[model samples]
Target: MPAPVRTAAQWAQFGRDHVSHGLGRMQDLVVVKGEGLDIYTSDGQKLLDFTAGIGVTNLGHCHPAVTAAVQNQVGSLVHMQCSIMFHAPYLQLIERLLPVMPHPSLDQFFFWNSGSEAIEAALKLARKATGRPNVVVFQGAYHGRTYGSGALTRSKPIYTQSTGPLMPGVYTTAYPYWHSLGVPPSTSEEEIVRLAKHQLDMLFRQQVATKDVAAIFIEPVQGEGGYVPCPAPFMNHLRELCDKHGVLLVIDEVQTGFFRTGSYFSVNHIKGFRPDIMIYAKGIANGFPLSGIVSNKEIMATLDVGSLGGTYAGNAVACAAGVAVQDVFASEDIGGNVNARAEQLYNALYALRDSPKTAPLVAQVRGQGLMAAIEFRMPNDPLTHEGLDKGTHIPSNIGKRVQEFCLSKGLVVLTTSCFDTIRFIPALVVSEEQMDKAMKIFTEAVQNVANEG
Candidate 1:
């Protein structure tokens, strides 16, 4: 017999009783179905989804091409242990992705089930390849939640609060945040770049030696770290540092991959920046659970034949979806859409950022392509006024308030990166009409929160 569907009250009670408390949900949304850029709730309300499942649903929810590919593959085959046999979908996906990769030498691939798994694989590869003991990452970076990735993650304390003694040999350094360094608002981008390089030098001098570091992991567009795009100068400098020290540079493109940004990958935006090993996930399969890394044969060969093989790695259904996603990206001119819509969002958001009504609470509006954010300053934040530290600093609370207001107004948004920035990562298929509607709701929500303050 088929299982019976539960009513809203029953489902709520079941979730309360059965779901693990470790999982954090943004809003009280029990979605029944999704299509395109909208999700239908159990209460029968259609919400314009701007979160895109935290940057997973790049081609939009249940894209027809992806759905058809998955359905077709599920009938023929689903699980194929990669170590035991070769599968067509997996092979096809690799063929589809290779042409669009930023670098010509990033030809080899290794598949995994999630971003965290891919990260762990890359960590092993780095250590094995370089014969080094330590790895370096940045503050405010969010890699993943596994013990290995969590050690590299610095976005939030709650992620590793009681999880004792995370993987050792992981070092953290300051990323370039011009606003947080207490630098003058008038500081030019060149000055900010110099400050960032100085901080990095200080880290190498004080904390971990560059020679001992096996790899320096970077998210070219810091996703959970406030949608802050790494300046090209910094990326070039990092490349130079890695070359000088023989440390491999690993780029984590989990959240920024598959046309979420205007490019096929965020690394393309940073001129001449390339990684020794690059991790991929989230948008690769348009919500399907699949991730992998790309590297040259020389770097990938560090992992012995038996070292990387999961039972469900490169599952046929997910790989089929990935192939379809690539096809859609090619035929649809998705990059063009992202550039146009990103401009629309940035203009509307900057207007709100500069508005006399909302300017006080707005710290910065920054993004590239469709991955964007409007950071909120705490009530007593220094940027809000020349001199103030009064009252409890609650930018996170303010972000939550704006998120809740958007939810009530029939839009689904999210808070990310230090818990103060309202992140907007809509689907690649989001239409111009939808963009106008979302911005209208978002502007009003910000105004409402400002009024409350």
Candidate 2:
């Protein structure tokens, strides 16, 4: 018998009753289907999807190639545990990834189910390889919510609050984000970089020594931590520091990989950049639960055979989807599309930032490629005029109001970090018309919210 269809309200009630309240949601709409840059709600509304499942469906929802691949793999072989046996899809995915890796040194791969799992695996590998007890992460970094990764995360207190006895030997340092440094948006990158470097140096001296640090984890473009891009000079400085101290550099590309940043990886935008370990997920399989870490052979060889296997690490269906995603990237100029659409989106955002009606509320417009954000300044708060203290930026509801307004107008966007910031992560394949429509809705939402104050 066919399952009975439930009304949108019934479905939402069911979720509320059974689902964990801890899980945060952007909207209450019960989405039934998605295609291209739109999601169809059960209530018969089609909304423009700017979040792209929080940057998961880079090829767009139900991308034909990825869908077909998943269907085929389900019929052929769905779950061949990685430790028990090697499947054709898993091997095929590795082959597909080899040619597109951001750096030639990142030749080895280990598959996992989520971004957090990949992060955990990278941490283990870094520690085991270096035999060091300590790890370092940047302020405003969001690695993941899992126990180990949560300790590495410094985006907000909410992530690590009350979760004490957390992973030990993890230290936090400063990232070159002007907003976090309590500086004007017009602050020079050189000065920001200098401040960040000084903070990291101080951390090494005050907290953990360089020799004790196993690896320094970083997001090329911070995701939940306000979509801040690490400057190239600062990145190079990290490489130099790592080289000088023998600390491994781990780049978390969970949200910045798969050409979402107009390049294979956000780090690729930095000239001649290479990480000791590179983590990837989110867009890897076009919404399928797949993530992995890549490193050179020597680094990977340090681990024991039994140390890094997961029962569902390399699920055949997800690997098949990954292979198909690679094929699509290879055949389509998705990177070019991302670049063009990013330019359009940024231009619109800049216009909003410059508009007199909204300029007071718009603190800064930042990010790269398709991964972008607009941070708002709370006018009534004294912090708006003064420099913000570390981790103490006054919270504003402007982003939430803008988000609500956009949702009312049939648009889907996400608020990020702990401040009043809204991020735009459209699909890599998002069309020009779709982008324009999204921007129109977003512009009105911003204007309406800004005018309210």
Q: Candidate 1: which pairs clash?
A: none
Q: Write the per-residue lDDT of candidate 2 for residues 163-196, one digit (tens) a residue.
A: 7878999998878997677666778999999989
Question: Model 2 clash pairs?
Answer: none
Please give, for residues 299-385, the per-residue lDDT of candidate 1 as tens digits: 988777899889999998999999999999889999999999999999999999789787767777888899999888765455544
> What is candidate 2's CA lDDT for residue 28?
71
Off by over 4 Å in 2: 1-5, 380-383, 386-396
- Per-candidate Cα lDDT values, in order, are 0.87, 0.90
> How far out, in Å, is residue 283 in model 2?
0.4
lDDT of 2 at 5: 88
